[model samples]
Target: MRSEHDPGAFLDRDGVINVDIGYPHRPEDFRFIEGAPEAIRQLNRHGYKVIVVTNQSGVARGLFDEAAVEHFHNHMCAELARHDAFIDAIYMCPYHPDGQVERYRADHPDRKPGPGMILRAQKDYHIDLSRSFMIGDKESDMKAAQAAGVPGYLFKGGNLVNLIELILKQIGRPLER
Candidate 1:
């Protein structure tokens, strides 16, 4: 199928894909949420665009830099690839209104609950927002999906792949496997 017609799975990074251990800027601190890679691989196998949208305010807080986040993502992606899963893209908000970093301190639209990142992805990837879905572990994540006119599912901390399966079923698109 053409990518332009493919729906997207907009995922939150911290709690959804990895354990939310606060400011995970280093690969050493990174830990995958149970079944995250398998869930992503299921999406990939079904022709869904698996994209990650995260709010990384740690950068603005001076806990870490953007390069650190990128490095972590690289490591995570490599691990996902080993499982035959791939993330189509990653969009993060490094800005925070009351941040410590002068350059990154600002209320940017890409921040969660703002919808800027998802909107940008919609435009860039030719995604159908009405058909797309967002998975997050926070209210802000759901709000962002609402703002972007996409359906949102909240994950209350557990096995990610199982939750994804339930989400798909609830959304009337149950996974075959």
Candidate 2:
């Protein structure tokens, strides 16, 4: 039941789009990777749905709150809007098994290495996992993508635009201007 318009690019927030400076929930601390905005804009131009799938254990660890995370997301979206790029949606896991917060102490399916967030996105947005891919910096990200049946690419930290271009080429879909 795959639709022709269901292709998507699932991106990990920290370490992919922004610098992983450890639980960055403040707009002041958010730093966009070089070319990250352009990469997303290219995806937009190509009619691909750009979704952010992230793990924000900071909430569980008591470093931040869910509201703060949402605020940061809003800031991120606004920043991307400046470059005419947009994220279709954002999914995050605020739970961790060893969380300091009792409410968020349990393991959640939405956490990385689990497929809940991806599955939820597929259901909500009608994404085609076969036609989609993920970019992340951790093995847990790969595991999550695998669980969701989506191809995952590892980013060893660099210019996002270049990495995206290389990924597209490897997938036989060279980015075109």
Candidate 3:
């Protein structure tokens, strides 16, 4: 049951967190974007639950398996923890309409522009959607947030920390520290 009443920061994994070099399922290839860790840490201090919602179509395309995705998430979490930033939870959709893998060949609602993943995260984290927001590099991310009743911000590169700070300021949420 959803019990906690924390606000969440839904972030896209690819271009938002790390450099999107195609379907990156390996830890060695996961290079964090500039100031990404600090941006998350800032949110942490401001009482926001950091959540990653990504669409991993590579799994359905036969480029990788769910195990690889899990391993990558683990590595990402460990790396973020090292910087005093952490993701409260991660939600990934591996299904695509034209997937090569038969098991994941259907168009899933958890996919971006559908709001399923964000809605699930809201339930799991008991996030206050009214106070939550999403940051992404794609228009689909914005649509997902809108569908979930959360505001969305389009990040067009540069330092993520700066963008995060600006968001916090615009939202008028005072920082704890």
Alpha-carbon RMSD, candidate 2: 2.0
Between candidates 2 and 3, the lDDT winner = 3
Clashing pairs in 1: none
Tens digit of lDDT per residue, candidate 2, span 1-177? 435556789999999988889899999999998889999998887667799999999999999999999999999999999999999999999999999999999889999999899889988998867778999999999999999999999989778898888867776452344
Candidate 2 stretches with Cα past 4 Å from truth are 172-177
Per-model C-alpha RMSD: 2.2, 2.0, 2.5
In candidate 2, position 154 carries an lDDT of 93
Candidate 3: tens digits of C-alpha lDDT, residues 127-158? 88878999999999999999999999999999
* Model 1 CA RMSD to the hidden true structure, in angstroms: 2.2
Residue 40 lDDT in model 3?
A: 96
Q: For model 1, how does the per-residue alpha-carbon lDDT over 88-133 read when each residue is reduced to its tens digit?
A: 9999899999999999989899999999999998888887766689
Q: Residue 83 in model 3: shift from native, Å?
A: 0.5
Which scores higher on TM-score, 2 or 3?
Answer: 3
Evaluate model 3: give its TM-score: 0.96
Q: Which candidate number maximizes lDDT?
A: 3
- The candidate, 1 or 2, that scores higher on lDDT is 2
